[model samples]
Target: MTQKNNHTIARSWDEFSEQLLGFIISRIHHKEDAEDILQEVYLKSINNIDKLQEDSNLNAWLYTVTRNAINDYFRNKQKNKETITQDIFTEDTDALNIKDSFCCLEPHINELPGKYKEVILLSEIEGLKHQEIADKLKLSLSAIKSRVVRGREMLKEKFVTCCKYRIDENGKLAGEPDCQRPECNH
Candidate 1:
């Protein structure tokens, strides 16, 4: 490798290693596995450094590599598993809290216009694939996809209007909603 490229890689490692490791750990509960993924990300960044455009953001590029590495790790794990176990797919507390927070949106979802309501119920609540939803509804796959997207947009608008939910700068739902209805209590 060229001296300048080596220097750039070293600099990136010094800056992003800790943050990348933390990101991996947040997704993967096992510390050892997270560390391994972090190392793989580092190696990938080293090998692919030259392919990165000169004007491209280095931080964003490294993050993309780290995310891909984490995904590969999970894919390999899934392929090797003969059967799924609760422990292997356990939901972290944060995920559970997020799910619970969305429960208040149930009533608002029902209030949506029929077309959107049907698609959202099947896709989100019933956990069906888009193709499955399309087949069941006898609609084109593109139509089903469009409905799901539009349904989510409508749902977000309802959350903002009915519940007074505000999105923060990061686009995440922020603060407690002023929900006074009995159905919104959950």
Candidate 2:
């Protein structure tokens, strides 16, 4: 990129990143992922700066890019989630899969921060619908949904980062954890 464009990007970063950081974090559950997406927004905006119709629209354009990045994160998360299932009752799932896959899950859940822990326990363990959770927690339906999504993503992050586990094609946690992270022993 040219020096002028580089300067422009630097200026943009200074002007908008602080505002967008909170905005991005509001939608994203993981702090590292949210920061990564914010960086992506900056890079994408710089690369596509010339395409923007007006200089005045840059702020809005950045917001658009940040929003799209968050959407993509959730979209990919959903696709990854599709390759993992909690349904151990199905004949195809088998008892072995359940016994081996979830040995560390309860401990990880116990380690979760309060709100995340609460939502996961309520939805997954207590079998409460999102609406029912909303009623009981006195949270908005959207807030309840957001908490559930965030809670699951947080758990998935822990599994991926600490346990080094990935969901197999058959929707089970496959392979052993690397045990590189301090809390990764499984």
Model 2 error, position 66 (Å): 0.4
lDDT of 2 by residue, 1-186 (tens): 567766776787899898998998887766887887888888788898777764566678789888998888777654433333353123354444444445546566678899888887677654668899999999999998898877776776666666676655644444555544444343
Instruction: Evaluate model 1: give its lDDT.
Output: 0.71
Residue 23, candidate 1: C-alpha displacement in angstroms: 0.3
Stretches off by above 4 angstroms in model 2 are 86-186
Candidate whose TM-score is highest: 2
Query: Lowest lDDT 10-mer window, candidate 1?
Result: 81-90
Q: State the lDDT of candidate 1 residue by residue for 1-186, as single tens digits.
A: 677877988898899899999999999887987998988998898898999888988889999999999899777654332111111112322343334445555576688899999987777654578899999999999999998878777766665666565655544444455654665563
- Each model's C-alpha lDDT? 0.71, 0.69
Q: Give each model's clash number.
A: 0, 0
Error of 1 at 4 (Å): 1.4
Model 2 lDDT, residue 95, Cα: 43
